[model samples]
Target: MSEALEILKKYWKHNEFRPLQNEIIDTVLSGKDAFALLPTGGGKSICFQVPAMMQKGICLVVSPLVALMKDQVANLQSRDIKAIALTGGIKSDEMIDLLDNCQFGNYKFLYLSPERLQSEWILERIKNLDINLIAIDEAHCVSQWGHDFRPAYLKISNLKTHFPNVPFLALTASATARVKEDIIKELGLEKPVLYQESFARKNIAYMVFEAEDKLFKIEQILKKNPQPSIIYVRNRKSCLDISSQLQTLGFKATYYHGGLPSREKDKNMSLWMEEKAQVIVATNAFGMGIDKANVKTVIHTQLPENIENYYQEAGRSGRNRDKAFAVLLTSPSDRFQAESQFINTLVDKKFLNLTYNKLNNYFQIAYGEGINETFTFNLNHFCSKYNFPVLKTYKALQFLDRQSIISLSQEFSEKISLQFIIPSKEVVRYISLNPNGEEIILAILRTYPGVYEMDTVFNSALIAKKSNHPEKEVLAILEKLKEKQIIEYRSKNNDASLTFNEIREDERTINRVSKYLEKQNQLKKEQLKSVLDYVKEDSICKSKLILAYFGEKDADECGICSYCITKKRSPKDPDALSKKIIELLQNEDLNSRELQNRTQTSKDTIIFALQALLEKEIIIVKSNNTYTLKS
Candidate 1:
């Protein structure tokens, strides 16, 4: 074994590398661009991580999801690796400190969001830092054709110009043939070695059932599997409602969505991770960074907008190489609803112009006024002031952010407590008045040595844990101190900033951009239609259909799928199936005994043919042994 493989086995406890992991690592280590299309739970992280360990400087991972970056950093720290995520949630001073650490400290990996790429300070720092490899996770986002396209990803290609020697590795769990080409073109990668694994999960049985009552179907599915599962809904409200319904059905369920507070989100996630909750009903926001490997099933209550999203979510199950199920429960109306959503949600040029105008009005800025000036924006208030739907308006602003016309900081509030508000001499006197509070107050003072002298934010929950009190108790104590004018406390919420690139907008340019967005939405609709056709088509093997969609050819039918099984049980000819019995069974429902008497053929032959027809869905079994035509 090579030296790199030895480190991988020693640290990761895996004797051998997964299919494409070793090759990917070798390509990256050799200082060449590589695009790796590994499915979810396929150890995409290890591809960069192992090479990062073997290489000389910090590996910079540009990820789009903040939560996912934090999760990966936490996982790395758990294994005694030095990692940090530079995100907008922290204070500017804190971010500077972290950047300094990455530059000076012996850190192996520095994960950052794509939005951070435009920061002049960050760019300056990167110019000097010894960045060994630049890895872009979810590289599909760089492509306009991808499901989750982000404009800021376009700035990443500039890194290649800045660091000419650094190799770039783009990794994504799901991407189409068009998206793959777009990723390569957008990221400016060389003619890199392309590694795409087969997009087939044999352990996951793909099943779709049409039902009027989806909750009932979910209950039936749970009763059959009764293992760790995820129920995906379309919106945040559905996440809560379905979870409540599941709880009433005697299952321990929790809900997760973007609307929940950070601490609450953490608590709910921990509950599910610890197996204290049997299931999690969530929106698409819940699964990005989740690494649980034993999920027995993944149920989607509605169709996803694209197959890429569907495949990534479904691939979450069966990570342990165990048999799992991926079921989609749909109704006839859902197809139309999804189509309407896709059409209506398109961020065309007119909407973008109107939105840009409204945003300027909100900031009270003229065409040339708002440049480099940063202020927190209230999206809800702006929408209300302009009489636009909040969700649509928010989406429009997101599009603007993508176009680099503005930047949005997702709302995040941080818990903060002041060390002291009174003079140093008055602290002893204030504590003497409240003897019971004096011990706790003094203990906090001693615990956080330099907090009073400097502005540093510490985790309140950690402080409470060390102080031997509930978090609420610590918060209350801080509140009491604040009321007495002995200390100060405050929290910061997530906000948005509008940054203009230029003073004037050309009308024709705006219209052209709008037309392009409309065309993109139309393309997305076609992609979705293809996905739906794949799901409902009964003639093709499910696995073969998916592999073919990703541009792989000559794929064989997966014999384990329902389509293949049904084919195997189908009768060669309905006309030769005990003719007299078929005649008797076609006219009315007849029991086996009655059919045998009328046909004069043995009961076994009649039964066998009937079973074959039933399996082929040509006949329906009516009461006990009675049979009737499917129509």
Candidate 2:
């Protein structure tokens, strides 16, 4: 125990470990493959971090979330631990430099996306590094049946064959019985030790409200709780709209979504982390990597598609073991919308094939030509060119990626700017001959420093504001200048910001692949519904429901849950009056005589008691006949 404490103090500041964490660290230190299924905010990272500190070689952590990797790496660096992430944002030369550092710089952790496993150069270089363990975060993503499946994760099993002696650790916050099996099989773990912490969060009060107006209910909830909270919506536009509404209502609110620029997202996250913002209105994309422990409430304005998502998101609050609230706001209309979205995602085989073919045709690639080719896809452009719904097309592409039919690069956009070459006077003279262009030209020159030298990317809105002109006018002036060869201009097509690398196939083949993928998606929806059914069920204990879902049979009902507490408070003999009424009826049809005969009671009590029995239909009144038990 002292040795464990020493390791903890030497690396992390803690003198002790969370429940089961020390045991997990010890197992990894002993060089064994382990699967850890801890709930959200259960110190999963420390399990790997502490072991990595005690190990003899670097620990290679493959994570699906880039934002999470960046955050973890920053934290590690702040602790004076050498850590680096090889992400898509880095240039090839820079990546090579980083990999070289990993090979020789004695770095203890190398974090990367699973897709990086496909990089031949990186794989070749790993042969020389002493990797003690390979840790896969969000291990559930490796399973096709998991809520968030990534095809690249399937390639991870190859690592076992490549490094036969190295130990592995797979960790996630949530997984069903099927998903657990899939993860074990997909990763090729050999009878790995499984550690599952109870999913019950006793401190979180689970409340579900049926709402006629969800927004109003949300406002009411905020007014009551009035603490640092997160209101999760379903889309980016909702994040903006709801945040705006909250501000109008005099709440300190901000919004976060994937559509925002990375810097803006980071800024909003930082604000929330620092508690400068009382509430964050966001889509599902916002909370994955957040570690703020004192989140007082998590209110869902729209019903989550499934229970796993609901559980994970709602579990975000109450991490400090203090009382917190997880509220779900649902209306009839919202339920219909959610159900519709689920149904729409069920694509027909013919439609899937047609869309797949259209995607191939849009890329001008034959069936077998696109295996490793990287192409930039514009969702809007693809929709316009192929007559497909933009949102559906995007989702279809994601499904294709999950099906391992293609690999997607992260999505990106282009920014164009101009740099000045000669002084403003020289450029003025060059374009002075064109009448009616001087104002726009001067505006352009004044807005940008080196407009005549080279092409640069500048924010269009900023340029418009500086020039005191409409953006259209500024763009026209730049285009005209480019035609005259007075300045060079180029459009930088940022990486697709998202990429989809289709597996090589003949265009005509795999047209029916979409049907199978759609079926798999429907099956997943059914599985999600089953989880929700457990939540809505009134008979089973809440703790027992969760435990059963995880394949733990024989778990007792936690007396602290709402269901158990309600049962405890309920009257044991609610129909006690019925028996007394029946006894009175045994002699003759008696109106209120039953109460007196059964027990000494007042007139008001007798009337109330008679009303309760009548309401329950336990007794019947024949036409003009005295009341008696309905036999």
Candidate 3:
């Protein structure tokens, strides 16, 4: 215990362990398998990391996300602790080198995806290493009922046979009782001690509001909090739109999604992390490895797919133990939209068979012989070629990736190359004719000196920045130049790539995974219903409702949640509220937010009072959307 505390203070510079961390570490130190269920931001990494540092040999960490693996490895390396990660796309020579390093280079931690463990060569190399512990991150992925079920995780238990004496620690942020049981059984933990910290976040004020204008509500929440924030949307378009809107309203805002180039994503993330951007509007793709503790508010503009996702995203707030907010703004149509997005897009067996067959045919793979074959995949191109719906096909591909039938690496990119076919004078004349293309054409010619001789690959983002134009505008200009025959231009959206891990027996492969698919779809439907029920509920405290969903039944009511506040005002007098609103408006015109602040009442009561006044013609909404006494 003293050595563990010393390791924490020496490396992590933290005086004390977060709640339950010390106990979990002690269990592992005593040579026992442990299952730890900590909430998001509960320092789950430390539970395994600190104890691993106190041991003799390296800790083998099996994670699901490549990005998260790299992040943890980098954090460890930053502290002068040697760590290595074996992610995808590594050449054999480099991989052998990395394995040798782990075998003899005194590396303290080795992070790799579960998919990597399936390779016989890598597994054999791992067997020779002095492995002290096995730490499984996101352990719920092994469960059929977990929010993120990855079949690759089921193969992790095979490691126990290789390292029979090593202790295994399974950690997750959220899981149901059923998921917990699945994790324990699937991971083959022998009499594993279970440690579950309470899921209640006392500093976060859970708030749900029904608003006609979600953007308006978001603006009000941000204005009131005025600290670092994240607003989660469902798509990339909304990420751009809302971030732009927030910037227009004088907030330093940025956006992030999987589609953005890695450079731009890092730039935007840096802006938000360094506090240059007060808010970041993003899709679910953000916040996996991000740990900014000062996020004062997390607002969900649309309904999430499940309570697990909602709870995890909401819990990102208040990590610094200050009072923060978790707000969900809903409209009448959100339920329909949520269903259309999540449930409607679910892939069935028939659709999956179609997708799998089309994929094999598109790649020209022969029956029973495409094992270990890799292909450069462009999802939009595939959809266009097969006349398939993009979302459903993507979902099907994701299912295949999760089942380890194929590895889908979604790293968005664009490959651009061009050659000046016509003479240099002709290109100059064309640029003059199209004034908007002048800057970009000149920047490209200057950047790529050999463009006049042969087709040269160019960095479009760099050219766009050099020419003071957006990347889309630069690409459009290049397209126009190609149309005019001044240059031979080619641009390809190389969005992602796929590697087949099984023989090309299309229908048989689909049949083998059909039950998992069906059960998962049913689970998704149930999860969606839970989300809707949670938002529709008004009597139960929001925090309590969330805690109970995760199998915590005895959580006390949080007085700061929207439900508790409304319950406190249940016996309110409409006349009294109306009078307060009237007096506040008489002095000056006030919007609903201002009125609520002045009267210190709930938003529902203010809206009710405002509606009554409007029906009786005692007050009117001005053209500016403010309330005023009728003259």
Best by TM-score: 3
Mind sharing the TM-score for model 3? 0.85
Stretches of candidate 2 exceeding 4 Å from the true structure: 367-371, 412-492, 495-508, 511-519, 531-544, 552-631
Q: How far is candidate 2 from the true structure (C-alpha RMSD, Å)?
A: 13.3
User: For residues 1-631, what per-residue lDDT tens digits would candidate 3 score against the true structure?
Assistant: 4888999999999999999999999999999999999999999999989888988889999998888988888899889899999987788999999999999899999999888888899999999999988999999999999999988899999998998889999999999999999999999999999999999999999999998888878887888889999999987767877988888898999999876668998999999999999999999989987888989999999999999999999988989999999999999999999999999999999999999998999999999888988888777557756768767988899999888888887454446778899988887777777787788888998988767865565667677767988878988988887888888887776657789999999889999999999999999999999999999998899999999999989999999998887777666688888888888887899999888767777677788889999999999998999989999
Give the lowest summed-lDDT range of ten residues in model 1: 410-419
Tell me the tens digit of each residue's lDDT in model 1 across 1-631: 8877987987788899988999999999999999999988898999999999997799999999888998999988988889999876688889889889998999999999888888888888878888999999999999888888888898999998899889999999988898999999999998788998878787877776666779877887888888889998997667877888899999999989875668989999999989999899989999998989999989999988888888889888889999888888878898888877766676667777888876777777766566666777765446646767655777787766677666666652234635576776788887787776665676677766655553344445555655666767777887888888777666445445556664535354366467557756777888888778876888987777777777777887777665676667654344665465557766788876566546644445667877777787877887686778778
RMSD of 3: 7.2
**Ten contiguous residues with the weakest lDDT in model 3:** 409-418
lDDT of 2: 0.75
Better of 1 and 3 by TM-score: 3
Q: Select the stronger candidate by lDDT from 1 and 2.
A: 1
Q: All candidates' TM-scores? A: 0.77, 0.75, 0.85
State, as a TM-score between 0 and 1, how close model 1 is to the true structure.
0.77
Q: After superposition, how far is residue 539 of candidate 2 from its true place, in Å?
A: 4.8
With candidate 3 superimposed using the best TM-score fit, by how many Å does residue 354's alpha carbon deviate from the native? 1.5
Better of 2 and 3 by lDDT: 3
Give lDDT per model, in order: 0.79, 0.75, 0.89
Error of 3 at 37 (Å): 0.7
Q: Judged by lDDT against the true structure, how good is candidate 3? A: 0.89
